[model samples]
Each structure stands twice: as C-alpha cells, then as structure tokens.
Target: MLVEDEHSLHAINVGRRLLVQLIETCKELENIHRIYAYVESTNLDGIHFYTMMGFQRRETLPDYFPQRASLTPDAVKLVYEIGNDSSTEAIQTFPVTNQP
Candidate 1:
C-alpha cells in the first residue's frame, strides 16, 4: 500500500521518484508479477495520478467502496505489469537517501 500525507510539503517529484523506485523493486522480486492499486472513482486526482504513472485502467468494480451513511462509490482498478522486462532486471539496487 502507498499513501502520502495530505498536508505534506515535499516536492511533487519526490512522490514520483519513490513510486518509481517501488515499481523497480517489485520488478526485481521473483514472485511479484504485477502491482495493483484500487482507486475510488470520485477521486479524480488519484485516478489521474496512477494513470500518469504507467498504470492501466483494467476494470471498474461496482460498489467497491464500503457503504457509509455519507457516501459510497465504485472503484477503479489499476495495474502495472512488472514481469518479463529485461530492462528492469538490470536495476538490482537503489540507494535510500530519503525517508517518508
């Protein structure tokens, strides 16, 4: 799971870099074939952000979100295929310079 503080003041690229590094790391793992993220349909920013990060919209799950008194919404399933990429295999390690 990935999350960021809403009140964070870090540079935008910082999040992108971290997410890229996560994908790279997942690609290196032998058992991990793909990365999946579930986003609420009402969350346009999240939908756009994951889409921009090479995740493809695969399916729309109806009533995926819990039904609350206030609101309920469908969920968008996004997936990133990390297996069988020769390029990602070369990157075995990355330095940890920042903590969030």
Candidate 2:
C-alpha cells in the first residue's frame, strides 16, 4: 500500500482504490504469499485501511520502523493473511478464463 500524495489532500479515495487494486493484482502471482515485508505504526491511515481490508495487527514491534519527524521511538507490524480465506475463495471460484 504505497500511496504517495504529493499534496496530502483529497487523495484518500484514490489511494484506497489503488491499494485495493494493488492487492488484487498481486493475486495473479504464483506463490506470492510466502513473501515478507515491514510497516511502521505511525502510519495511522495505513493501519485503518489495511485493517478494513482484512489485514490483522500482529504485534507492536518496538522500534520496528524508527519514528521520523519527531522520533516517537517505536513502530508496529501488521499482517494480512491473504489467499486463504473467503476472500480468496471468491477469487478461486471465478472461471479461470476470467482472470486477468
């Protein structure tokens, strides 16, 4: 969910749509679930969006992603257990020909 709003205004909706598409697009990958990544806790909006998108907050890893612009001194990790739920079931149910 790498959303960049040069102005940081009136881009939430666009960011949301892009994020959704990003996830769905990755579904086309072969065995992509086994990948790993990291996210900072200060990303409040990201946390909200990921949570609503079914990504669960795994734990609050201190100093995970060093705080910036004020140095809060902590960060957190959120995990999205994708490709193994009702969500993926819908994708798998679709006809193979419809995938793109």
Best-fitting candidate, measured by TM-score? 1
Give lDDT per model, in order: 0.64, 0.47
Candidate achieving the largest lDDT: 1
lDDT of 2 at 69: 57
- Compose the digit string of candidate 2's lDDT tens values, residues 1-100: 2334334543557755755675676677644442122344555655665577666666776764444554334544555544633333322110001001
The CA lDDT at 93 in model 2 is: 12
Pairs with steric clashes in candidate 2: none
Clashes of 1: 0
Candidate 2 segments whose C-alpha is farther than 4 A from its true place: 5-12, 34-39, 84-100
lDDT of 2 at 65: 43
Model 1 Cα lDDT, one tens digit per residue, 22-56: 89888678766677777766666667777899988
Off by over 4 Å in 1: 5-10, 69-71, 85-100
Model 2 alpha-carbon miss at residue 92, Å:
24
